[model samples]
Target: MKSSESRLGQWPLLAEAARRDRLGQALLLVGDEKGCQSAATALARWRLCEGSGEEACNCRSCRRQLDAHPDMRHVRPETKTIRLASVQQAVASSQSAPLWSPMTVLWFDPVTAMTLEAETALLKSLEEPEATTQYLLTAERRDQVLPTVVSRCQIVHLQGSIRASRPFRPEYLADRGRDLQEDLTAAAEAVRGRYLQRPDPRLLELFDVLVEAHGGIDRNLNQELTRETVAMWWRQTVGPD
Candidate 1:
């Protein structure tokens, strides 16, 4: 029930939640990485700040020993998505006592990308509460999560880092991807469209360049070299005209 505006023009709306004693055992923070992390860090700091006036802080929760933290377990995705094995390990570790703080935080940054199976395995832990454990799950979008899982926690919206998008002239060619051939083909179509509008011989030459690259694919030519050729051509083709 907080406004869209961020706290300090950066952090998430966590003041109201903390004031009302409504920071749930399982909290779902929805937004960009920076804001959600700021809120999570604020929560951690607030808890530790009570005991330590300053440094020599008896709160040994966040001292980075190699890769692990004592009272916090950050469950990161293996590659593109969180795996069931990672969730299971965090769930199993959830039972252990917090070495420093009163509660332990198990954080999953942007749980939206979690695979169906991984989310299912995590769903149980979210639904069931542990007296000494706090679940901090983040997401870029709320819709990415399972409805049942979303229902079980206190949802906090955050102001993520807004980035300015690089301008792309051809709308169709804007969605270029890793596949060099696919993007080159789209660029060729872009050039054809340009030629239709302006009747430029240069565009026809660009179209031929893309076609020549496509031709190489049939000959089992070196893709990396061909892609580099197209990239250099594209760079040289743009600007001042």
Candidate 2:
């Protein structure tokens, strides 16, 4: 596994901007979901740091740790989809002034989880800006996000390729079993992102394979057999990575 330092090293400009407190108001991070989420956390911690601690932080931020930073709010999907209410609450929080830190950070990991209405509500927040609030949105796929939302922020692609040659592979339908539904959705969305980047017909076919496998699993088909079948399909389709 790669360390955060190694992963973040590829994004020097973002790190420099964060350290200097000059990052833009909102950023659309496109990459692996875990990597994007971690990047957002690191950026928020640096942006709110007081430049006084031995390791990183000092003062109020130090007491509770950056993990518990008062001014940082991480809004993720409680279920498979982010509801409008959750987005609305996050918007209200962002609209408020910062408390312990110089700025407040509104982080939405994998903004693709947001439902249609939720995205609309979030768009309203993006349309209206507060001087002290910074928004960080991460998505495993690009096309899954609304163009309006994408236009509101600077886009950053943090990864070179989809880790899964295809999403929802019977073996990798998920990323370590975080959540079945969410993982499946994220996986398909990720494939869509890959297709968008290269306009590959193969990616769409891979995505279709994922959906069919999902349906089979939902019907209580033998998971082992399903996985084997999917693996074979993947091998035939993609052929040796």
Q: Which candidate leads the pack in lDDT?
A: 2
Q: Each model's TM-score, in the order given? A: 0.55, 0.59
Deviation of model 1 at 218, angstroms: 54
After superposing candidate 2, which stretches have Cα over 4 Å from the reference? 1-10, 19-22, 52-55, 160-241
Overall lDDT per candidate, in order of appearance: 0.62, 0.65
> Which number leads on TM-score?
2
After best superposition, candidate 1 residue 110: deviation in angstroms? 1.6
lDDT of 2: 0.65
Q: How high is the lDDT of residue 190 in model 1?
A: 57
User: Candidate 2, residues 1-241: lDDT per residue as tens digits?
Assistant: 1122332333543532343343568888877867786677666665565554223334567456655777878888897988889888878987777887767888887789999999988888888878888888999876789989977876655553223333444456323444443344445555555566887778667766655554444345676665566567666755645
Q: What is the Å distance of residue 185 in model 2 from its true position?
A: 30
Report model 1's TM-score to 2 decimal places: 0.55
Clash statistics: count for each candidate: 0, 0
